[model samples]
Target: MTENEREIVRRITDVLEKMASGRKPSRIEYTETDAPDDSTLMELEAKVVELNNLYAESYRFILDLARGKLNGDPPPHNNFVTPFKQLQSELRHLTWQIEQIAAGDLDQMVYFSGDFSRAINQMIDDLREREELRQQLADSNHAKDKLFSIIAHDLRNPFNAIVGFSEMMVQMVNMASPADLKQFAEMIHTSAKQTYNLLLNLLEWSRVQTGRIDVKPMEGDLALLIRTNVNISSITAEPKQIQIYYDGGDSYPVTTDAAIFNTILRNLISNAIKYTPERGEIRISVDTNNRFYYISVHDTGMGMSEEDVQKLFRLDVIHTTNGTNQEKGTGLGLILCKEFVTMLGGDIYVESEKGKGSTFTFSIPK
Candidate 1:
């Protein structure tokens, strides 16, 4: 073969070798016309030999063509380069697949026939998991923002009343008569009680959110606890002529938190006293089954619709209703009652009609 023909064959064979090797061909250095320096040429030959080993397993025909071109050997009789050409096409396809995956296209599920494909697929799966976790965290933050927003807006009214009423009563005491002073004192006491109850509920609810209200089971008399709270709350009820009664004389005892038991009674009795008209009646009763110790407080007062009962215990919301004698309610007592009852392994439920009355029933394990 002539020198020009040999050079052409070498260039074509170089392209074929790169196609089989699954790598881009480096720029060819073809300036020397004479046989190259033995040492430098031998180094290049060693590299080609290393490639030849890979080509023997992957593309023997391409390696044979490259060697034949370098030696100025005759071309193949049939000129068939079909199999090597197909290998080059597959290499181009793999390069495009890598570029697509890098550009955020992970929909293609690469078959794990080789180590290279498996490594790339694993990387894609890791990226997808991180993206999903990021989205979930963003959603959680959004929900927290909404909760705090509701809490801030709803808490403002009760706080304003407590502060305003406290300051006003202090100023009025100096100029008032004994009778007027007594009324003012009562107003101040009621406002202070409301403020204190609000704070207590807020603290308890925070504890509940932090998983602190663990129910320590103990035995206690449910009826006696109810009667004691009713007696204590009677001072507030008497002035308005609200009569309180207990339907069950039986001293039923149950395993629960006694402190929370007192809190539930105080809140319910207070609510009954606040909402009932003068000369109205409130009733207390205890009933039990195999599974539960049920206590109920029923009042013939200004009752609520289904909607008001539904929102009764929500901490991030505020609701209020006026007493018959224009008594103010901060709405925190019912929320506190609900939380305390729940902590004692109990559930609270309410039943009411708009015009007739309201009943709050709670049950704890017997």
Candidate 2:
């Protein structure tokens, strides 16, 4: 464009600015008569070109800024709902898997393949191992039931014969000479007593295995229980010349299952008598502290070694050794004692050396 045209446009803008400021220009500035020099014309043209470039760049910048702002905004709520719903569903699925495992469904599996997946797989493996262990326990119990059943059925014959034949033998002995009758009666009595004791142990063990027995805990006199057991066992102890003694501290009252406790006391005392040598003495004692009572039965008997002591209370090991007096036991009595003691929240342990005396200590809550 020529200098004239450039001036006209500039004048036009000045007029508009003055009008916007609410002021009128002193005079009109437009002119078609003055012709600019060559240098002035080129300068005017450069100014026009600069203004056009500035406006075009500014418009492009504003358009790009608007587009950027739109991109920075968050997605629509509807667009987010699906993924959010998916996350909630996954959490619910995990919670259900945990519940199933807690409820003992060992076979259930969680379909996850992350760090949590490894832990879930480990838990399932542990449950499977536990189930296998439970099955093994059931099989062992079944075998025990079968063995006890056989023992129970087989026991009747000897018991019946001993009772029946002994009564007739007594009649025959009474008819015999005085000296002969005394020996026969004594033999019959001894045999009957042995059979009775065996039956008692057998029945008690069976009751314990079947979970039929209920232990009733109460305050009891331990000293009385010991003395009574010693007296009852003397019949078996006397012939072996094994003197049974109760050296327990004064009347000790302990909280325990009375009937079961009595059984434990009787069995231990009789077992001591059964195992001890001639002239050996068995001492029973009760020691007490602040929280518990310790009842120990010590015997100068053919004591067991470490191996026998280890397997002593296990039903499967069957550690049965004949007493010095040839007295026999089913090896169930000690196992029953341990079971009953555990049920009463008590424990039994033995300390012994071969040929040395054995001490069996049991503790009950006071």
Candidate 3:
């Protein structure tokens, strides 16, 4: 064409070639001249300059995105950079989701299509499962520590008492008075019984932890079971003059695992006798709702505070206290009662006030 058109064509070709080669193109400029094609050439040159500027902006924006500089200035609104802007928005959202996940929100999920989405969701699920297992392991370790503490402290005390008192009795058998001999014998007996109860509870608790205990339920006389436990517990209670009163008329029928029921009753009765003062009273009573039998062991004993009661069933806390007669406890009996009650498809609760009394009630399905 003419010189002006030829110059315009050359500039446009150079700009297009630079852009095609992924290089920033220089700004296009055209001077106004008194030629017939000047206006059209100038117009074309303006379009070329605009295209070069757009290409430079797009290239910078894409470079920032590639470098993970998500907080930089966003691309201008244009058809050419629309997909990049959308990608930036998605990436910002993903960053926020990742931050939330890092802050312990495992529920965050990525929904973008492709392997990234699947990988992120899978990571969240794995983190949640790992957290659950970590919590379980911590609880298991705490339980083990509590058991070891009881065995080391509580079990050792009773055995020491038994051994010390029996040895004293043997050494003084020929020289000691009848009253002293009887006293030593009684001490040994008390310590032996305590040791036996602790050992039995430890065994049963271990069975429970191992998932080896089975519930064997049968229909039987509930009152007889209560009376039996009360009778056995009375051997200890009579010394403190703590009277146990159970008047279930000898024929309270119920369905339960008889062995578990007996163990629960034995512990409750023993606890009551242990804590109740001389001349105090223990009342065993049963009430029935439409679906369950509620058995209560109410005792006029040195009761616990609200805080101590709250600590009673938690494995992470050991809440033992001396009985009214300075009787030592491992605080394991109530824990066992709770476990056995739960195994029998029941729940146990306690109501007590400091220095007033405590009532332990458990429900069994009728």
Candidate 4:
């Protein structure tokens, strides 16, 4: 064949090889090595340039996908390039799939049929779990903020009352009658008691929140525990002419933490006294079923609305009410009671209507 014909044959052979292998062909470096005419050489040069351009576009497309830049510009869209065109189409689909996942659509599944798909799905699951935990922590932090506010309010009121009453006494002790002195003293004593109870509940609740309160249950007499707390609580109740009764019979036995049980019972009885009218009656009773020991404190007091009952024992939504005689309440006692009761493997509830009365009930294992 002539030199010109040989050059044409060589270029044709190169094109066929590239098509067969489905690989991008590099630039054809045709120069004056044999000096074919300029026009024939230019034709071969254009084909080579086209092939190089196809590979360049394909390279840029893969690079963009790797860098996670899914916006702007696409790959070479020519159908003559088999694998490059196919890859560009698939990458567009992958981008849409990822966008769906980003927009809170976990149900948008990817079925790429390989380890790659499995890895992507696992990543989605991890992201979802992290979001859920983040939300829970936020809610917990919000509740803690409310708790601190209640503490500040409870502490400030009693201290101010004590200080004011003491100041009045210091100034008027010489001129005041015995009746005035005794009244001031009693006021001081009441403020001190409210402050002390708040501190106790605060300390115990802090320990429970930090997961440091350990429960050690033992075989014990429930009747004796109720009687002991009732005696101690009567100190507060006697002043209001309230009568406290406990008929928890001779030997009601249960397995429980004595200290926690005592605190729970004391808080309920104290609350009943606070809400009950003067000369009212509060009866403590104990009953049992096959699974648990049920204890209740029933009172004929000024009860509460259902809305107010729902607000009790929640740190985030606290609504503390004063006693019937305008007595102060710290709001921490019931929260501590709830936590302690839960720790003792029991549940506590109250049945009260606005005009009627209330009965606080709790149950623990036998």
Point to the candidate with the largest TM-score: 3
Which tens-of-lDDT digit does each residue in 1-366 have in candidate 2?
A: 776666756755654565457442233322343665455544554554444333333433334433542222222343323443454456567778878889988778787658888889887998899899998798578548645643774455446656765776667864777677666667667667777877787788778777899978887877777788778887768788888888886688776788888888888888888888899999988888898788899999999989889988776665678788776666777888998888878899999988987999888887
All candidates in order of TM-score, best leading: 3, 4, 2, 1
Instruction: Give the clash count for each candidate.
Output: 0, 0, 0, 0
TM-score of each: 0.55, 0.60, 0.80, 0.68
For each candidate in the order shown, give its overall lDDT on alpha carbons. 0.70, 0.72, 0.86, 0.80
Give the best candidate by lDDT: 3
lDDT of 4 by residue, 271-299 (tens): 99999999998999998899888899999
lDDT of 3 at 224: 83
The candidate with the higher lDDT, 2 or 4, is 4
**Model 2's TM-score against the true structure:** 0.60
Q: Can you give the lDDT of residue 132 in candidate 3?
A: 100
Off by over 4 Å in 1: 1-176
Q: Which stretches of candidate 4 lie over 4 Å from their true place?
A: 1-136
Better of 3 and 4 by TM-score: 3
Query: For candidate 2, what's the RMSD?
Result: 17.3
